[model samples]
Target: MGLEEEIQELEDEIADTPYNKSTEAHIGRLKSKLAEKKEKLEQQQSGSGGGGGYGVEKHGDATVALVGFPSVGKSTLLNALTNAESETGSYEFTTLDVYPGMLKHKGANIQILDVPGLIEGAAGGRGGGKEVLSVVRTADLIVFMVSVFEIDQYDRLREELYKNKIRLDTEPPRVNIRKKAKDGLTVNSSVDLDLDEETVKSVLREHGYVNADVTIGEQVDLDRLIDGVMDNREYVPSIVAVNKADLIEPDYLPTVESELEERDIDPEEAIFISAEEEKGLDGLTERIWDELGLIRIYMDKPGRGVDYEEPLILREGDTVDDACRKLGGSFDERFRFARVTGPSAKHDEQQVGRDHELADEDVLRIVARK
Candidate 1:
């Protein structure tokens, strides 16, 4: 009989099991056989054809790219993140070619691209600026690296991106300060200033709060700014890495944090890590993984003659039905049932229905009639 006919017969047998004790063991045996068939079907499907082992094309996995001005430690961070031997140096444009590496976290592998350092006027075809930013645009996430020691570094980088029309959500607003903090007036204490609403709006606009309405003494929402940066790309998330933390003085950390806050970026999302020292690398990796919403699940079938060592990485919302659909329409129609063998399984081996949700490291054994 065909796979479909076999599944139908098993279903009928299961329905009649309670009615007849003579076929109870037979029904159980059918269930086991069906599970084995499904496992083989899925294994064949997974190995069909794909660039990255998941039977999908390139860019199927979430991609994160490192971007920043020259000599900003982008290459160093890439090396630290992936343990890949990417060239790093204090000289500008040390990395002329884009290097791709996979960083595995919690079974999910994230493809990270390290692009060449960008300079001012990069978008205008100057200093290979536009070409570099174009590459950055394709990235799902952009890690903007900056050196704290450089005077007005943030402003300079923003100006370069603006001149090139390289869109960055965190550009600060421009304002002429006619009123300074009064002598002996501390920042903690409030002082009256002759500033109009338009002036305040213009200032806020330069600080990356374009089209924002504001009032004097009113607090600005930083979370909204972070959301704006995230909205720069569709469905892709971004994270900030505050590199050279070891070089900067401890007292300067708060000021840097406040500046980022003013630009609408959260201090928490901006990780402070020394790529050279490998300090806080774990935290950075975890943050990136969390933001990407990726996970890995493995199917272990010892006697199934399939590779169980490598796990499948999937998005957070992926389901068993979704996976089957990815295989092909026929597989979905022929899907009889599924069984899982892993730490999360209810029993040593349990039958799973069509609507079953898969967890990380789940060793699934699917049963198909054929």
Candidate 2:
């Protein structure tokens, strides 16, 4: 049978099969088969070379994508956060195209993208889903904007992203698989594994692994094992913003926050704001900056004072050599050493080498060869 037919058959088999401790292995194998078919189908469909999706080149220090159901004020948020003129409306799907904006915060430039609103079946290519969902996979951060009244829609948006293999606020399963020529399946786990060896072997076999070495770093159940074996996934960090807070009463805002907390939303991730009213924007900006983990490097010239107005923006853990490369010249080849005067240095004007790791607000002066 074809991939679709095979997928449907496997789905039907999995649905009809009894789900229990005894039938777990059978169900797992069937699910693995289904996942493989679905992946293959997606590849085949996307491999057609037809390009009609919204493609935004990543710019600035980092790129953050605004994702939510329609009429969640993503356009308004983009305008408030950046200099982009994203059209806003009271209707759904107002953002027909990807709108790019730049948010300048703490001497760092952050690119904010207002994408088409997502709906149910988005990952399945519904309601311009393929184009919209494709942009989020490349985001450094996903701002899940939902209306204060429709706070529950955040779960639905997250679920759709999950179905598309975009894992938000989650880490990849700690399982590794190494294929071999003839060595039979050997499963080893550093921690207690709940999935039986036979089940693991069956799932691997369904994924076309007849012989392999499986290593599990942590305790994982059958679903985790399958996820590891499937292996085509993206782990992204996401934050949920409750927009249009001005529409709600002040006293009722606490109740809304309480409901969000009960749903296990992190206080840092879940914030109340009204983009139109420009309320709580500073907190939102700070939260985005912190979540992105950016570091600023101050550059100084010889006999000139440091320009703290626009510092060199770099990702956390970036080194001096990386900062030099950002200058867009042959400075990397002409590099000798640098003077450091920040938390990373011993004292004022300490001479450091090229490999010195830089810290935030560190003043640097690169000395080139004569």
Candidate 3:
């Protein structure tokens, strides 16, 4: 009958079916069909255009979204970390719109978004969840904020993002496909595959691939295979911040630490902060910088010394060519060579080319053509 009912039926069947070698192909086909149904339903829903999306324009070197349930101190955290005066309140849904702030850390301007708190049924488009989740999909990183009193909210937050097709902290599966004419579906893999070729073909056919050459580089389960076939997912890195640490009693610290461990997040690694008191903001900023994989490169401008006070920010593993491209204008077209002196260089002021990989705090001098 209806697409929603059809999707639920497919989901129920896949869940009810047993998993084994004999039933693997069946389950895979069911999963493919379910994914197709979900995709179609999502398209229909998007076309209906119910919610008013946020007017959040990505800015600065990178953007991070503050995601959590209501009254998790996201606004307080945003105010403490950046210049944005986000309204902080003790009640739920305090932030009705997306408030953007800029944090100047390590010579990088990082854009921080304090959006409305994500409720439990966000993936189902409840409470303007679709609009909020849409803003999050564009962020470079997601800072999962939860109160020390509500550490369990972390799982629900991640689950909402997952249902919205926002995959965190993982690379896209290396599944490549090339369409052909009249040769039929063929699957190839260097590693041993868990799914039989039939299952792969079923997924391809569900996505309307009749004759194609498919290559899967690694072993993937049904979900990963589906993700590979569907290219609309967003892969992002995330950091967990347990806010309002000052409210927790000393005796309950171990219990708090235990909860984080249960979530597979090291208590030491997770940033524990009292956002209202401005405590642990330093640690949070440091984690943001590290997780963003940013590095500072001091440019050696001619007729002037190296500018270390305002170093150019670049992502790690970036090369001299990348630096040139970032500089924009004539730097890219008139480039000749470059000299580097710092962590990335073999020696001080070593002559380097466009392919030279720059490290943090590297002093770079581009010898462009006159």
Poorest lDDT segment (10 consecutive residues) of candidate 2 = 46-55
Candidate 1, residues 1-370, lDDT tens digits: the string is 7655675676676566673344433443444444444434434433452212212123546777676667878788888888568898977778876777778776556777776756655533445454555556565566666665542455665555544334554332221222233332111202243333333333333333433323223232222222222233222345677778899878988888888777666887778888888888899888777776665666544366434466666667677776577555476878888787665469856788777777656777667766
Two-way TM-score contest, 2 vs 3, winner: 3
Top model number, lDDT: 3
Please tell me which model should have the higher lDDT, number 1 or number 3.
Answer: 3
For model 1, state the Cα shift of residue 89 in Å: 1.6
Cα displacement (angstroms), candidate 1, residue 248, comes to: 2.0
Per-residue accuracy of model 2 over 92-203 as CA lDDT, tens digit each: 8888878999999999899998977577457666556777778888899999888888778877888888878888887899889998899789999888767777888899
TM-score of 2: 0.91
Query: What local lDDT score does residue 212 receive in model 2, on the 0 to 100 scale?
Result: 90
Reference-based lDDT, each prediction? 0.58, 0.85, 0.89
What's model 2's lDDT at 216?
88
What are the runs in model 2 whose C-alpha is more than 4 Å off? 12-21, 267-269, 303-305
Per-candidate TM vs. native? 0.57, 0.91, 0.97
**Candidate 2, position 112, lDDT:** 94
Q: Return the top candidate by TM-score.
A: 3
